[model samples]
Target: MLHVYIEPVPKGQWGPIDGYRIETQDGTRLSGELLRSERLAVSQAKLHGYVPLLATVRIPDKAVAEHWTPADKAPVTV
Candidate 1:
């Protein structure tokens, strides 16, 4: 299970104001044109077999990264 960290795009960041950005715990970033909202970004991560986590605050791009053990990649069932 890949743990993905998600947070909103900062006020003056590169992405849209209402957009969300996602990245893995290991600092691997994921990009998408449709990540216009937090829910959409989480959904996208789920679709990629990643477990999404919401961040309380914005995380710096150059922050130290840590790897996590892989878990089940089972598809989410409605």
Candidate 2:
């Protein structure tokens, strides 16, 4: 089976927006657009006949900063 590895594009390496990077067993690598979503990236790879084997998706720092809440500040649950 064709194997494809998907991972996040590091900040500033490509652009401001977080994108996905795909690497194949044959050493072929492709970086998605600055604004490409993980799903979209995977879909594009699938179109090219790459089978998903291992995928890693990282939340953008901007997004984590905006959505993350400290445990101390989280609402108490019963």
Candidate 3:
């Protein structure tokens, strides 16, 4: 069983199924989903508590940029 933090995309205009960003305490981030009427269960033997099965997208370190860049494409003259 895995516990993850989910951050939803803004606006909520993506229909019933929207995208979410999932992250862990160790700084691991991924994409996931949240749906209504979803039932999740886990055996105590596996996690010692309840657990939910969810879908998540994988985001690699390279995919994330530490700093923000200019939106417009312009060559920087040093």
* Candidate 1 lDDT tens digits, 1-78: 757876566633565356666776565678655367666777888888888766443444425333221223323212
Each candidate's lDDT (Cα)?
0.58, 0.49, 0.31
Model 1 C-alpha lDDT versus the unseen true structure: 0.58
Best by TM-score: 1
For all predicted structures, in order, the TM-scores are: 0.58, 0.49, 0.25
**TM-score (C-alpha, index-matched) for candidate 3:** 0.25
Q: Against the true structure, whose lDDT is highest?
A: 1
Q: 1-45, model 2: which lDDT tens digit per residue? A: 465655556733545545556665554675435425656655666
User: How many clashes show up per model?
Assistant: 2, 0, 1
lDDT of 3 by residue, 1-78 (tens): 454433333323444434344444364553334322212111211233322222232322323343212212222211
Q: What is the lDDT of residue 35 in candidate 1?
A: 68
Query: What ranking emerges by lDDT with the best candidate at the front?
Result: 1, 2, 3
For candidate 2, give the lDDT of residue 31. 47
